[model samples]
Target chain A: MQSTITGKAYVLGDNIDTDQIIPAQYLTFNPAVPEEYQMFGKFALSSVPASQAGLPKGHVPFHTKDEFVSDYRIIVGGKNFGCGSSREHAPIALDAAGIEAVVAEFYARIFFRNAVNGGYLVPFESVNRLCDRICTGDDVKIDVENNLLHNLTTGEQWQLKPLGEVAPIIDAGGVFPYAKKVGMLKV
Target chain B: MPAMTMTEKILGRHAGRDSVQPGDNIWVDADILMTHDVCGPGTIGVFHQHFGKNAKVWDREKVVIIPDHYIFTADAMANRNVDTLRKFVAEQNIKYFYDVGTPRYKGVCHIALPEEGHTRPGEVLFGTDSHTCTAGAFGEFATGIGNTDAGFVMGTGKLWVKVPPTMRFVFHGNLPPYLMAKDLILAVIGDIGCDGATYKAMEFDGDGVYALNIEERMTLCNMVIEAGGKNGVIAPDQVTLDYVNARNASGKKYDVVTTDQGATFCYERVYDVTKLEPVIAKPHSPDNRAYVSEVRGTKLDRAYIGSCTGGKMTDFRAAAGILKGRSVKIDTFVVPATSEIAAGLKSEKLNGQSLEDVFLSAGAKIGQPSCAACLGGPSDTFGRLNGPISCISTTNRNFPGRMGHKEAKVFLASPLTVAASALTGVIADPRDCLQ
Candidate 1:
């Protein structure tokens, strides 16, 4: 599902792992449902006690189809985004969240490839501007193809490079479809 | 002219047109190709899509498929990937399909390959897993490739490789007890920055490499990637072939070779470890190595001794020997890299009993053959911890709190060291309990 409208941004904090991407407990029950906000709430607000913090109150304990609701497409994370496990589902879940691209400073080799092959775009940028300036809910308009990430709320722009050497493949709809079009594989 | 290395020579031989030099993009044929469950599923789809018909893999015999991350802790999506690979392997008639627990299958990826006699000297080996460089211990130029690249290799039997300049690391002097190839490599990683060898090939030189057993060499080459090297190779000698012959009874008439007498190197670092203590890599970064004694009293919630890096047969013996009469601290998990390693230990009737028993007595859960807990590539959690937690692991990497929580810490060490630490429940030099 392509984004409803272009010119959007998604945001995330640092140290995003495959486990928090889709907690292991939900793996058995649901095969293909997005849960973007389901686990992040716990991880982001972990240290901030529920009674004394500025985080939203808890809802259902388990992942639901609603957490996939989108308002963001660009993610600004710290070093080693998508670490832990070679689970392609981590990117698949993000694609299900309608993420046009990720704007992490760096990524694990496997996760970077999985995202491109899954047809989800991830344009990495130097986190210099967005590192401390951008908040969790800040709106970022990242034109990954143009090497730029612009925060709409704060009017800050970050220059970045789209997926290295593999973005064209994602535009063709994952590796299989890309290879099929290139006559590398039989359709 | 930039001097040539063994890897370039081998890749040149495979390239078959002209000599390939460092920094030159050379297309060479792969002698052996492997993909685990994580990368296998994607390659399967690409193989069919790229071939324009039923997927006709370049070579069925040389290719192997193993489900590394999806055994006991099955992720539905990963299992789907496994199913995709299984069905494709059958359709393509791919011969070496190693389901977990199968006979002749055991330990981490590199451990299983050599045990099966798949890796050989002078070969251009490739795997879909990063630590595939472990095969270089057999004196081959082996490296890891991504899924898409593997897909291309699976369909076409060839991939582009940049022939890298060779960096010779000369080790001299006798290795102290409890100081192993793992410690040696960690120290090297410290000396040379993690990216010091990026896109370059590493060859262990001097008397030290020859003195160390082949299993120990695997440990050295296995984590070469963590140092950003594409491959790690050691010239094959009699000892190398001896380890090969010992594995599978495949007296395949090995042609052992060495680097030309005065092969040029891009860089050479030396270490005498004659008096080096047990080494441990601190948390968040594998390159941050320190003496084990320096990191004493670092408590741990887990201890893993499996994975391609430290899952060799001798590694088990080293750990089991050090752990003979001692019991493991509670909450340690011991997973053999492959089932054959378990079988080998079991058949040896270690300590006049089962290898599993020794590990169990040492407070380890005999985990099934798979890369587990090491990377959380499978097992999801590092378990609820008391305060800040630490883990002494024999597997690769101690990436920022890699085990579980960010507050948690991981220490990278050898199988012997990890087992001893698991017994003590804190970071202690294995030599402490040795004599």
Candidate 2:
């Protein structure tokens, strides 16, 4: 919820689905329980490369090296990022992995809302070909108030759009807190 | 005032506004809310956390809980998921909880939503499952949301939403016997690619689309999410009215919303389905589409027909028609979407042969009406992808490891194509196998 932020970027390709974010195998534990919820953090994006222990044999567009730092604050992706499944787990996993925000050309509608409403991450819709311009391990700074994303490594900046009504919800930390603040919660 | 699409009309009505334009944000009342075992437990947890344990649901009768995905599996965790739903349903005194092992237990939330009279024309519906958009086939403005959104809906009976721009896909001319609704949708997805319709309402119309039966329409709408559509809809006609009238106990006449003539759209595309051939989405992505003839002779280890998308009685009949008097060379699995469908397969006959008999005689394994292999169940799930085998499935997705194994490749096809491929031990056009 910070107005200004800086982080390392982990770039990914198009259609990075919920399954790839958190595979079905790791979803066995209930998110309702605190102890089980922590399991999500440990296994976030664990199936990026299907060849990993329980994953299938397919190319995952993101980094899968065991030694790679999981704390990439800014994740960049192409069109329709988080395109499959309605699992908030996708955003939960990303947030658990310490992703502060996601910059994508477009996003699946449900995933966009989940990320904002769950207080998992801020989804910033960047200009086209933004993924090509941003490289992995690059230092990126997001100016929330100005709606600008600065690529400090490339010395380029991209404009971000206002989230409209979603901004207040995000500022409230999540849908539940937003509802409480707006008096939507009767109690 | 501008002419409004059905989606705009429905949302506007619910929002208590005269008209709504695309991108307009509004809060609307939800007529029905659905959740399944996979996400239902979490939804319930959030609902209780926000509303308190003693709080009553906004409307008990409007909420539906179905346990479909994790049920029927040997995995203890899967079973526990359903147990959690059962406890929540009991505590809430929910009337529409479809518990596992009950006679009324329908399979696949999408299919069950329509079968149990929950999906009426022009009603806004919401579910935790992504394919909730399938209900939009009944002329409703239904879309999928996450578990947390579903939780909020359960507590307040309302949701804030942005009206999405619509894309109209007009399918003209007569569809060929060799082709199905599945083929038409696949062709559209291929043309538009996976991200083509993101955040857009795909309104399917034209003679070719209206000519299809309710089941075929469901098949067409079920896969809209694959192309990143928020929802897919067909304006209600007599065919839709008849189906709803038969199932609806109240005998009430539901409003049928239609797109005004000359309604503005963000994009418009038309397809002459007569020229369309049987199409399949190749391994890895639903947008990787090609004609069945192009992929013909490609060897496959398995062929499957079942899911909310392809497990309807009509789909089984089509597969049975192709598999009649033939033995499948590859591992073939057939599943009905609901118990009613299962009963129909047992009782209904194709040329005096029951679909169950046709499949069983063709060396096909029949599974109970659950999402058996669609979501890739626990080990021992019938027809689950094991290892690096290639499969042609009627299921919507072909994403890697979707069917169970990461190495296993899946081709998304119609039931007829699947049956034809199972008989030939390779991908083959259904037309080639038809007598």
Candidate 3:
């Protein structure tokens, strides 16, 4: 929905499942309630082992202690991101934590659908494995229109896979709006 | 029209088309939309937000709310979430609300759906849990979806689906005595990595598959999610029909459909069940496969046999056979998948002793029939791993922090293997005990 999203990248390795994204223990916080929904921000990525919390040099927390919003706005991940559960809380937690877009090699289907259907955040697939290339705390900018990711910190750039068939849905801001726009739902 | 796979045929019929192919995205009517305590309140919120605060559900009978996850916990929010389901069911007049602390309560939705006759052949079923694919054992199109997609289906009995190309897995020989459906599926996931079947349909077939009981068939389909499958299916046979007919209380008729001759599969794999050894998924990932013999004697602090994948009667029977008259060396937790199965533990017997008696006599702890520690609920949850302990479990996942503690290690194996390991306080091969 935005022209470009710019922020520091919090990188992670492959198979960062929903359990690691938002542990099942924190799942009792209902996203329907405003306060409980914000709690997702505080605990986003809380279950990821400290050794794998941040890539390359680990032990980086997504959010500071007791803070609802994260300092980082972008996430770089390897294959099968959000693989474990079908809980939409995975994407909602990342968005609540101030992540604007996630650049991963590929994603598990249900997580991709949840992110796009709920309009939670942009899930962009990079042309190559970017987690190995990008370091945590690297300033990055995602140009949505061009499907390009620029590492402002390293002065490097990479092409991202186009949104393909789901672009219209994401463009219209998720399924409900896309349906109305495509005449599947009455306007 | 060209030949169509079972998945295409099912989606085609629902979409009102004579034929469909892989990559075709069309809206199909949903026969059942199941939600649980974990995702139910969130789905209700989305439904009310988009469809108006007072909007009625598309059809009350089509929506099923099962409160299985996070039940029996002292956590306030977990209890409140069930209350949320109760209120929504009352307001929407939903017909199939399995509330906790009630007679109608069931422990897990995937197992409960078929037991209560909600799963049928040639119908489309959706649930909030990934293991909903377990119902595909009945020749149905069942897959897991998120709250938003579930909410959309709640407001309308229809949702968009992309027809997936089927990958046929044929097993050749009969299952050996040391093997279970868990071993067969683990072999599949091992061959193809965790994301191997992403966005594809997995169909199990052959005489080997047909020989399995209904519960064992459910086990085969339950872990397809681990392979990133959109859905898993099997053509309805006499075994499937017998179970559904006995339980179809509503008297709803279902069509028995099969793959057309010459139907093309995106991929195919054949296994000789007799040749395959018992396997275990090592710590940290489901695809980290190792032969039980290769990892034999690996140290473990506990053993668990419970979940939709491993807590059924068939699983318990297999475990009880190994655990009979043997005292466990480590703490072993045995939780059934549903109350009906739980009751079977009391009524069913091995060597003239009840299954519960066998487990208790083996020094294994029996917990209430819920997803006790498969996903590791509240801190006080029964059998939860609170410290960095190593466990051999029959549950599907062993991802870091999957059970409870972030550093806890989990090795996934079949019930027989887990029982053997429980007796030795290490990962032990079931073949030793079976012989």
Best by lDDT: 3
B1-435, model 1: which lDDT tens digit per residue? 334678878888888844566777566888889887666765565555556566578888878876665566446655665676678777888777776545634446677788778878888888877788898999888887765667778877887566788898988987877777888898888777565676678899788888998889898998887767778999987888876777632344444545765667889888787866788888766777888888888777777777777766777887887777778774677677777777776776674977767777766777777776665543442232223577778878665434445455778898778888888888878887874
DockQ of each: 0.14, 0.60, 0.80
Which residue pairs show backbone clashes in model 3?
Answer: none
Candidates 2 and 3 compared: the better one by TM-score is 3
Ranking 1 against 3 by DockQ, winner: 3
- iRMSD in angstroms, per model: 6.1, 1.4, 1.0
TM-score, each model? 0.79, 0.95, 0.99
Q: TM-score, chain A, per candidate?
A: 0.71, 0.86, 0.97
Q: Which ten residues in a row have the lowest lDDT in candidate 3 chain B?
A: B426-435
Q: Residue B128 of candidate 2: its Cα lDDT?
A: 92
**The 10-residue segment with the lowest total lDDT in model 1 chain B:** B378-387
Candidate number with greatest TM-score: 3
Error of 2 at A41 (Å): 2.3
Q: Can you tell me which runs of candidate 3 are displaced by over 4 Å?
A: none
lDDT of candidate 3 at residue A86, scale 0 to 100: 97
